[model samples]
Target chain A: MSRALGIEARDRRRAMLLTAPALVWTLVFFVLPFALMAAISLWQATATGMIRTWSLDNYTAFFTRPAYLGAALNSIEITVTVTVLSVLLAYPMAWIIAEEVPRRYQRLALTLAVIPFWTSYIVRSYAWSLVLSRKGVVNDWLAGWGLPLLDLANSRAAVVIGFTHFFTMLLVLTIYASLVQLPPNLRRAAADLGAGPVAIFRHVVLPLTLPGVMVGAFLTFALCIGDYVTPQILGGGKDLALPQLVMLQVGRRADLPMASALSIVLMALVTLAYLAMARWMKEPGK
Target chain B: MIRFAVSATYMALIYAFIFLPVYVLVLFSFQDGRFPIPPFKGFSLRWHQAVLSDGHLMAALGHSFVVAVLSSAVSLLLGFLAARGLAHARLRGAGVARGLITAPLSVSYLVIGLGLLASFNLANVPLSLMTVTLGHVVINAPLCFAICASAMGAPQLAAERAARDLGAGEIRVMALVTAPMILPALVAAFLLSMTFSWDEFIIAFLLSRFDVTLPVELWSLLRSGLNPKTNAIGSLVFLVSAFAVLAAELALRRRA
Candidate 1:
């Protein structure tokens, strides 16, 4: 029995040893950095450097400054628009891929849908900038068709368009996974009960796949809200999202305290999103 | 018939919308003229040649490759060990450990980059590729851990037990038995991490100084001016990454 106890103890030690490196890495890199950021957020930024005095000056400034608050609002607006548009657009594509496409071709179709995602994200946004430029493809194409050119470059619309394009692909993948996992018999059963296609879809298909939609939407919110590249490249300098604001504070102002506060705010938004979507974000079999 | 037609049209439009930017970017990269905008001005390889010869861009590319590979390899190793330890051992606080490892996934890249930058500054560690690589590891390791942990199952546990029963050492059981058993997961984790690290902008942007990554270099290039060279470099990155994604998919499909 003592030998068995010794074996168990040794195994426990081994497990600890195996997991220690990762734990330590996460502690030193991830947790400690986040803690430092939170701590720095409370510190006051002075002319020469950060003052050790703990204050709410940065957070207060964020709330009181119209530009800062506007940036936050812009971020929320863009994120919401992107999330909603992505879901609306992706649902049909995901539905078509799962329900309409031939089984053998479904994988190919999905791959083609998300092929652009393989491109560098920064480049993708830059590509959008080129595409939406005054003398760019869309305008050129419009001119070809005798249509009036629209000014989209460096606008919130352009940012939304860029974000929607990427998130649509992501949402399609997630929603498609859930759609395909749905047992076909459920639909057949609904049909046997004399429910029409729309009714069956609304009641059966939609409810079952709502979790996937929620998961995808929440992810979109988390990513889109915190993204600096998309807005910086596409939103032009006319408008600033929260992330752009954070970068501005860090890069130009060298206000580490303000940047940290802004980051904490952004983190809080993501945390709130996660809490809201917590029910549907669990592992599949969980 | 009308519903089918509508769906087909919608799909076509969406596909067009999705491919528009990629199409424009690639087409303009070959433009003989300076501007990357319309009026193709006939195809030319000048921009591609320019990208290939530009020492700064090439150096940035090499730096990106090194950071991606090293960070991804470290992430995969740490993730695999953690996943294995959690899967096999009925240890206390496993749930907490898993949570801590996977928590970074929910956080944004900007936030992670900012946090690391702050911490590194506090430590008086000057920004370099090493710091950028460390930042990448911080972001990607959680992802690797999640992927590896999800792929662990009863079959691998049984195989591991069998190896142990055969008087194999713990390290041998892990290296020779468990590792091979979850090779697909490991590959997937590594490839995914590498892909993220390669294209990751914010962390590398915030951390690196002289040895900037490709995305950071591209950012400066984009800011410097509107040149077809930017288009060429972007196209090149797209082509290489697309090839990698295709290869990974093919490998995973074959394994499955």
Candidate 2:
């Protein structure tokens, strides 16, 4: 036999041995820092610096001040809009690639779809700002059509467009992966059972791909809510997103405690997103 | 068919939408005027040449490269080892270990950066390129681990078992058998993390003092004014990244 008690012991030991360093690294860098931040969030940020006294003052302030609460609400609104919009846009493209494109060309088509994302993330936002600016390309194109100019730069709409552009690329790859994994015979079998194309798509294909869509949507939400660059460059820093508020606390005010509090709230939002995705994912299996 | 025509038109419109910003960015990088805005002047290469000569941008490029390479290497090594372990043996609490290792994937980069920043401030650790690398690893290592773990299923386990049955030592089997078997995953993990680190901004911006990465430098360049040099550098970045993605796809396609 290839397996024995001694070998089994060795295998288990080796597994532990192998995972130990990575676990240690994660503990030190990822987990410990989060723990530290949690502790610091409970502390107070004085004018001089951080103080050791435990207080809920930052969280209390976050609730009491309309600016902070409004930023959080705006972050949620923007993230949801971008997530749902990108998924809607991307699902069709991914479906086309999976269903319409020839097998050999599908790889190239997918690569082309995601190629724009390879650019510097910050540059992508800046480029969109240029395109959405009053005197930028969008307005220029409109002018050629004798249309009214659009003053979109430094607006929430500009931020949503930039974010949608990136997230759509991401969602396409994901949804395509799930789409291609469906066995061809399953669809053929459904057809043989006399199901119409639209019916098959709704009942069979959509249900199967829902998990992937949810995962992509959750990723979009997490990334969009935390992103400071898109809103900073395109939203023009006039209205602060949560990340911008956190950054302002750290960069201008040097309030580590307040930043930590803001980050904890950000983490909480992401955790809620994760839970929701997990709940939705469980339904597809049923 | 009407359906075919509809799909075609829709695809064309989407492609136009996808290419819009990139088209403008590249077109304006060659604009002959001071402003990057509309009313396109004649083409010129002055901004590209000027960006090439900018010392701070060049230095940031170098710093980004170093951080990408070094952090990716460390993350790949850790992730590969952990994946190999989880695949080979059933350690008690293996799920917990795996969860802990990959937990960072669920967290946002901003929150990760803020956590690191707060901890470093508390500990008085000076923010530097190393700190940025540390933050990148925290984010990228989990991703690397997930990719490696996914690629280490039945085939890999069989190969590793065959090597062990033939009397290969653990180290030899890992180095000579298991690793080579998952070499594609290792390479993919390394390359993908490099791409991420090279473009990552917030962690770099939050964790660095004097020596910033290219994205941070580009952000400042963008904010300092509306300069075509920013466009030039951005176009260059797009060019390199597009080439990398094309190369990776071609390589993987060939293998498949």
Candidate 3:
């Protein structure tokens, strides 16, 4: 019995040795850094350096300042619009790939849908900028057609277009995973129950898939809200999003405290989103 | 019939939308004139050659490759060991350990970047490629852990046991038996991690001082001018990364 207990202890120690590196890594790089950020968020940014005073002055400034508040609002508006539009757009595509395509070709269809995602992300946004620039293809085509050309490169419309383009692919990937997992018998059962198509969809298919869709939507919100490049490249400097605002604090202003505070605000928004979506995120009790 | 037609047309249009920017980016990279816009003067490889020759862009590409490869290697190692450990020992609080490793995935890159920026400043660690690589590992290790952990099932565990019972050392069992058992997950995690670290922007942007990743350099290049050169570099990166993706898919398919 003693020998057995000794062997068990040795195994336990070995396991700790194996896992300790990653656990320590997370604690040092992720958790500790986050703690430092939260601590710095309360400190004051001064011309010389950060003042050691523990106060919410930076947070207060974020609330009171129009530039900061406007940027946060812009972030919220754009994120919501993109998430909604992406779901609406991607659902049809995902549905088509899952339902309309032949069995053997579905994989090809999905791969084709996801192929563009492999492009360097910044280049993807820059590509959109080129497509929508005033002197770019759309406008050139418009001029040839004698239609009024749009100056879209530096606008909210452009930012939304860029984000929606990316997130639609993401949502399709997620939503399709859930859609494919759905057992076909459930639908057949509903059909045999004398239910019409709409009735079957509303009662059976929608309920089963809504949770998965919500999860994807939550992912969209989390990703869309925190993105800097999409808005930075597409929105231009005309409209600053929250991330751009945070970068402004760090880059031009060299205000690390202010940047930290803005980062906390961004995280707060994500935490709130996670809380709202917590219902769908729970695993089914097995 | 009507529904099928509508769906077909819709799929066609969506595919068009998806490929539009890629098409235009490639097309205009060959624009003979300075402008990358329409009225495609003619085809020329001048801009691609320009990117190939530009010293800064080339250096940034090298930096990106180093960061991606090194960071992914580290991430995969740490992740695989952790997955192996968790799967082997019935240790208390293993759930919490798993959660801690995966928590970073839920956080945004901006938050992670800003947090690291603050930490480096507080610790007086100078921003450099080292710091950027560290941040990439943080973001990517969690992904690798999830992939590896999911692939570690009863079959792999039983195989490990069999190897151990045959008097194989712990390290030997892990290297020779368990790893080969779940090679697909390791390959997937490594490639996925590499791709992510390769394309990661905000962290590399905020962490590095003199040396920057390709995306950050592309960002500055885009900001510096609106020219065909940017299009050229962007197309180059896209094609290279796309090939990596296709190769990854083929590898995984054949392995499966």
Global lDDT of each candidate: 0.91, 0.88, 0.90
Candidate ranking (lDDT, best to worst): 1, 3, 2
C-alpha lDDT (0 to 100) for residue A77 of candidate 2: 92
Global CA lDDT computed for model 1? 0.91
| Model 2 agreement with the true structure over B1-256: per-residue lDDT tens digits | 8988877787777788888889888989999999888888989999999988999999999999999999999999899889888877877898999999999987888888988887887789999999999999998998889988987888878887898889998899989987787777677778888888998999999999999999999988887766688899999988877766566555445545
Candidate 3: RMSD over Cα atoms?
1.9
Ranking by DockQ: 3, 1, 2
Q: Which numbered prediction scores highest in lDDT against the true structure?
A: 1
Model 2 regions lying over 4 Å from their true place: A1-3, A184-195, A283-286, B154-169
User: Which docking category, incorrect, acceptable, medium or high, applies to candidate 1?
Assistant: high
In candidate 3, list every pair of residues with a backbone clash: none
Candidate 1 residue pairs in backbone clash: none
Chain B only: TM-score of model 2: 0.94
DockQ of 1: 0.84
Q: Give the TM-score of each candidate.
A: 0.97, 0.95, 0.97
**What are the runs in model 3 whose C-alpha is more than 4 Å off?**
A280-286
